[model samples]
Target: MKNTICPKCGNETQELYDGRCKDCFFENFKLAELPLVLHAKICATCGARFNKNKWANTGSIEDIVFNTIEDALFIHDRAEDIEIYFEPRQLSPHMYRVKVEINASVMGMPLHQKLKTEVRITREACDACSRISGGYFEAIIQIRATNRQPSPEEIQKCMRITNEVLERMHKKGDRFAFISNSAEDKDGLDIYVGSTNASRHICKEIESYLGGSFSESPTLFGRKEGKDVYRNTFSMRLPEFSAGDIIELRDRVIEVRKFGKNVTGTDLLNGSRFLAPPDEVKGATLIAKRSTAANAVLVAIENNELMVLDPDTFETVTIKKPVLLSAKAGDEIAVVKTSHGLIALPEEVSRKNNL
Candidate 1:
């Protein structure tokens, strides 16, 4: 290396940084700089932080303070291999004092700097929170049954699905994913949602878990910024029959196991697997529930036929044995009486009764 003279310091050195020797160059060098005071906007309800003109989910208050300090910190242009650390202390619920340490190298020489700043939190309602509190909704989901009222259990499950979907959407950065209101009517449940997209997701989730279909329609609600604003209404129809329902369809008594996109069940008369589309059993009549079945006295097992005392008449009657029948002679078994005749319930139903 060749020696050179610094112009500003008039010193002989091996290198000159911006026409200055190392000693003269470092005299006014600053590794980092930070403002004395910083402000961070946080949502009071959800604890989200406002950053870069948008609301974002953040960590705890201390993490937010540390992030704010890091964002406002400025490092020297010549710095290399920079490392930064923050030590934050909460002065109060709305204020924090932070100490920042910066270590870097410039021109093969190590440098260190320490800075301090105060983070003052400003709490306010974010856009989502404000809209939710104001009862602003873009969609209404009406949960109804095809031919009956929605049971309390079904309604509760639907609401649970709606909330779960909205929560997932909100975590995925959809700020409008929120429920504004919900109500129960004689027919079913009515849910008001802030995001139409979230409403569609909720309806899809509900249909996937429970059996049914949904349709959507839009109506003009108002105008915004010279554009027509519309609100969506989703009509969700639940399946006509639910699990454990014993329905007589086309002369076959079926016990519904699941009713999703397709109806799945076991034929109560023969204990054979029965699967069909939702539209296939449209006119099925619900005779009774598996829970409502009566126990009959088993008289004898004659080959493929079972002789059991009628639950209603106490008269011995011969009926075809179900494929899943496990009861021996003289043991009580579950039997459901339909207009067709006495139908022996499956072994699973019998076990449920024992439980």
Candidate 2:
């Protein structure tokens, strides 16, 4: 029988069961899983998840339960060891569904992507097995993202920036947070921040100087600032001045009652030298997120293994090895997600089969 290719996009696809491609099925059922947010069903036969939101096909799922709750075994620094409980995707023994449960899985994200995860099937504690006295069941071995798979050193630059920003907030009592993974309301922002109105003016000034963005998140993001309170003050009048009571601004001497900043260039009783031209600031950068879904920046990082996208063209790429990267700005790399922060790459990702 001819294998089924993705009829929709004409790509070779995975077969979980029956004979439909996962990616094609997902395209047909957009927004299928609202709560889970899975793009596709990894294994459709029995609701088992092979990978996190592979957005593949139903039967194509290899049978993995993501965020499958189980009793914790032991706690390590960044990961935990646990004995998991799960069932197979294929109902009967004649058919089998490859199911796996990983440890230290929070929500659906595997902790750090470098822990040991083994897949085993303990059929049951049925009467026949109970009498066997601690009988051993069949166990299948599985692999993690980094298992004898040589991976590049995990870069923590984003973490460093996040922590640094948090430090700045703490000192000034400001509010901020990493952009939520599923925040669709915020079309152009990667991070949300809240600050005093006074601080906002300062923040905006800093943004103009440093270059980047600072936009308001949606109402769901919570109050941006505390309520403003007005302080009562008694208005005061200045005492009368005598003739030639000197008033000075840089190189100009003006009458006390003359136009206060109402003075423009020629209106300047003050000379041009009285004002130094706008400060020749160092070069600044402007980072504006693309507002639409169609246009995307295919930026590749130069000199470094990172890439940044316009969020519209964000397609996560996971490779067996760290991809080659150019660390120079505008150098060009495949825009991809690596279980890391949004960054650009040094080179466009070649097909795994092609590589």
Q: Which of the numbered candidates is closest to the native, going by highest lDDT?
A: 1
Candidate 2 regions off by >4 Å? 1-163, 172-186, 197-355
Candidate closest to the true structure, highest TM-score: 1
lDDT of each: 0.90, 0.28
In the range 93-197, model 2's lDDT, one tens digit per residue, is: 333332333345332334322222323322223221232233321111111111122112111222234345545653453322211121112111122222233
- Clash count for candidate 2 is 33
Clashes of each: 0, 33
Candidate 1 local lDDT, 204-258, one digit each (tens) = 9998888799999999999999999999999999999988888999878999988
